[model samples]
Target chain A: MELITWPDERLRRVADVIDVFDKALREQASKLEAVMRAGPAAVGIAAPQVGWLQRLVIVDVTARKGTNNGLLILLNPEIVQWQGSVIGREGCLSVPEYTGNVVRAAELVIEAQDLYGESCRYEASGFEARVIQHELDHLDGLLFTDRIVSRRSDLFLRQGGA
Target chain B: MAEHWFMLTVVGRDRAGIVAQLAQTLFRAGADFGEASMLRLGGNFTIMLMVHFPAGEHSLAESIKAVAEHLQLRVHIDPIDSHLHENEAADVVVSISGADQAGIVAGVTTRLAAVGLDILNLDSTVAGSEASPVYVMRIEGRAREGIEALEPVIAELQREGLDAVLHPVDMLIA
Candidate 1:
């Protein structure tokens, strides 16, 4: 599936509330999981990335499984409580090839729905928690670029030619 | 495949060519890096790197001796195997950012001290406007023994108006 381009309008609108858990929705989520697994070192994916602005996300840290923390998905996610501020660098597939150091909550207790609309709660920390917060912000139409503390502090220009 | 682990330490006076010269020495001795953490505070350059190689490919003791002679830097190496590789420690990751102030580190470490946390690694940098610096700190270490439940105490520090976060280190895939 081709990535949704910037300014596609779908990226900005408040994503549609996922109200149904029918086969079509499940199929869409499966495609998202496939895309996420195939992408470069990504831990999460959102609907807007594929031009579907339904409140949905999927994440699995199983690629590094010895830590006993992996595989999570959030549909219509909402962060109910957050404590502490953390500064870390993040990269996005949508932005593609640019990374910025942005500050986010070190831990969060979030409420979200699953693909089947069953409610789930997530309490995460470290990089896993960061990934959740980053993707959820995308549902609200916010990108990491907006949360970046500064252009130079966390931003890096990847070397290409040299 | 032969596997060996060693705790390697490098300390020398701060200078521009230290890392380059050290890298050349390591390359010549054929030591592969397993994990590395380095810092420059005040005038001292301190380095701790975990290195590994095939079980019998090289003698770690002899390699350290050669690198020490070549680089003229204080270097120490200790060998360990599967039973004592120090795999059982927890880690705490802290992130802090605010309009830079002089007391940022003081405030953070003070809290950690009150909670009985022993910091193992810390990396911090400052950026932002010249007038107002944005200070960030990332810490990796095990939570202090017997004080694993102090996250809320740490959380309370947020009310003082600095962006602070503390959490257990999670799957560092890279």
Candidate 2:
């Protein structure tokens, strides 16, 4: 599946409410997984990147997890509660090759739906929390670049790495 | 189609209308300030911008030079190969523990900078233990080509009495 392009009006479109658990939805989820895997380093993907615009995202912080571990599939995810504030650099597969500092909740408990249509709750902190929140923003058609808080003199556009 | 993406940063004493003046320059040049995060650190204002233009048509260095001179600000601009992009880079974990001191970051980053390493996450903590204060730091970054030779740099850091470790991070594809 071809990833959606930037400034594609579709990217800004709020995802459709996905209220069903069916074979087709699962197929779409698989397609998102494929797209995420196709990138050099993609941790998660939302349905919108594949042009579906559904309120669904899949995040598995397993690779970067030190203790907290689980695959998170959030449908219609919402940041139900948050505390404190922190800044972290983030990059997105949909936006391709640019990373920026984004201000996000230091800790968040998100209420969302799973692929099985089951309600799920996630409490995340540090990198895991940041990644989940980043992908969830995509469900609302938001990008990491949209969340930056500083314009420092040291950020570089990288090139030519493995 | 060649698309050019550049990370542009401006840092200097905080004053009035710096963002306005700098943004004006970029807009006049037909380059899109794709993304930006900026804040005032102490009395200095810093900005990180992801700017883009169609590749094969213009040089990012020239654009950065024009903007830097016009805005009268310190600027650093580097070209991001469209192929390597953001997601294609390799991640490395770096942990550093040392006596509280300045230039610990500078010492480590200076070496990584020479090799085109991109820092992804950096955390530094200096804690008071009621006895001996401890300073510790950990960073995640992506390595460019020739970064494998940084073992010597790590060895040098170890000599500074700072415990340092560098390991490649394998990203799991979704």
Roughly what TM-score does model 2 have, to 2 decimal places?
A: 0.56
- What DockQ would candidate 1 receive versus the native complex? 0.05
lDDT tens digits by residue: candidate 2, A1-162:
778867787888888888898888888788778787787667777888778888988777676747453777788889989987655556666775655556767788988877788888878886677777887777787877777664221221111010
Docking class of 1: incorrect
Quote the TM-score that chain A achieves in each candidate.
0.86, 0.87
Which residue runs of candidate 1 sit more than 4 Å off their true CA positions? A65-69, A153-162, B1-174
Predicted candidate 1 versus true structure: per-residue lDDT over B1-174, tens digit per residue: 135767778887776777776766666677676556676864778888776655432476565565566556687777655332233333555566677777888878877767767766566777687787787676545566544655765676577777766654432211
What is the per-residue lDDT of model 1 for residues A61-145, given as tens digits with 9 covering 90 to 100? 6665434246777888898988887666566767664445577787788898877789988787756777888888778887787
Error of model 2, residue A152, in angstroms: 3.6
How far out, in Å, is residue B105 in model 1?
Answer: 25
What's the true lDDT of residue B139 in model 2?
66
True contacts kept of each: 0.02, 0.25
- Using TM-score as the measure, the top candidate is 2
Best by DockQ: 2
